[model samples]
Target: MLKIQEIREIIKLVDNSSVDEFSYEYEGSKIELKKNKGTAAPAPQMVQAAEEVKQPAQQAVQQAPAQTEAAPVQAEESKPAETTADDANLHKITSPMVGTFYKSSSPDADAYVKAGSKVDESTVVCIVEAMKLFNEIEAEVKGEIVEILVKDGQLVEYGQPLFLVKPE
Candidate 1:
């Protein structure tokens, strides 16, 4: 059995390294970890044990191609002028952990903030539920909410942009 701290250490190593996927097998137990880009949170790691299974073997890790030439061309053509107009001045608040994002405290409660709402460093902008704990995410920046980037009850990953603010 792997300890929580050990798992965390592995996650940290994987996050810093270029490897996209890792797997290990010991005795009859197996574990796999995969990194999902752009989500800002690590995917859930799964561990399973099988009785009378063969000894574990290490699998070759396959690295993805660096980039495709066509992707950049499409991105450049699809970008609108307005996207870059105010983006330079906008502050983005991102998720600090992987969890389900909620716009309100409860199902019937009003949303914490919306477009044009004024906020400060301590303002609770939304809730992120992880391991049955509801974590209140703050603005951490004094600003006016210009846009909400995520939907209520959406699964948000660490570093995923949640809101766009026009800092005061």
Candidate 2:
């Protein structure tokens, strides 16, 4: 028989490793752990180009003619670089409280800030729903989003890094 803590440790170990399947048996008690290959890490940086609330409209109104084609290429090139940013120079937007994180004001609306989206101290970066109340989370630093650390509708813990930003 395995203790609860031991089982939890086993699960974490299996989840972080490359092994896709695991099984164990002791004293007629059996345990099995499997990683779901279908679920890509819940990171949202890959879909950033399609996100960005108030970003596209603002950019289109300002530099549409000059950036129309270049923006698409930039997005593709940045995909590879997004994974290698130096965290030492980045500002992290962390969850202020334990709650469920939401990327938009509503399900159908665009996300507040995606990779490459610029943000200021007052910018609403995400929503944290706690105790039936939706609290809007703000980005307190001025910067461009370098990565989105949390997935939409995911549970977040207090002080968990939600987004990584490169200061402007």
Candidate 3:
């Protein structure tokens, strides 16, 4: 995984270059950055694209040890059966990019949402900071926030569930 500092440097270089997209791969990890031209701010957005990179099962097994360090935490994150059943009908608002999750727009501001907060598709529920740029994340689903899956400043992976909402 690329450190936040390294991502920032890449963003700086890409912002200054003529290229609108940049991609890099090392070992099994891949990073792709794209710049949206019409946005008010010219910040590069990091997006994960599906790639067909097949590796030997032996190599995959060898990498398991390095990846399994977070297994315990992941196991702990699993919801109880009852809770899982209750939330089965809920909608998940997921991260579109890998970045540090932020509950509020600024350090002094109140969080955009919390448990029981009602939101519509256009509602900004949180911010995810990538490469020093704060990107406001919309709820996308019409519902009431039932749970927050990530803590403030936590690094989140692409497609990770950030909020669970009880659909309206």
Best-matching candidate per lDDT:
3
* Better structure of 1 and 3 per lDDT: 3
Error of 1 at 115 (Å): 0.5
Error of 2 at 21 (Å): 50
Tens digit of lDDT per residue, candidate 3, span 100-150? Answer: 899998889999999999999889999877666566788877989998888
List the candidate 1 regions with Cα displacement exceeding 4 Å: 1-81
Off by over 4 Å in 3: 1-76
* Rank by TM-score (best first): 3, 1, 2
**Top-TM-score candidate index:** 3
The lDDT per prediction is 0.67, 0.64, 0.68
**Window of ten residues with lowest summed lDDT in model 1:** 54-63
* TM-score for candidate 3: 0.56
What order do candidates take by lDDT, descending?
Answer: 3, 1, 2
TM-score of 2: 0.51
Query: What TM-score number comes out for model 1?
Result: 0.54
Per-residue alpha-carbon lDDT of model 1 for 57-79, expressed as tens digits?
Answer: 11012211222223223333444
| Number of the candidate with higher lDDT, 2 or 3 | 3
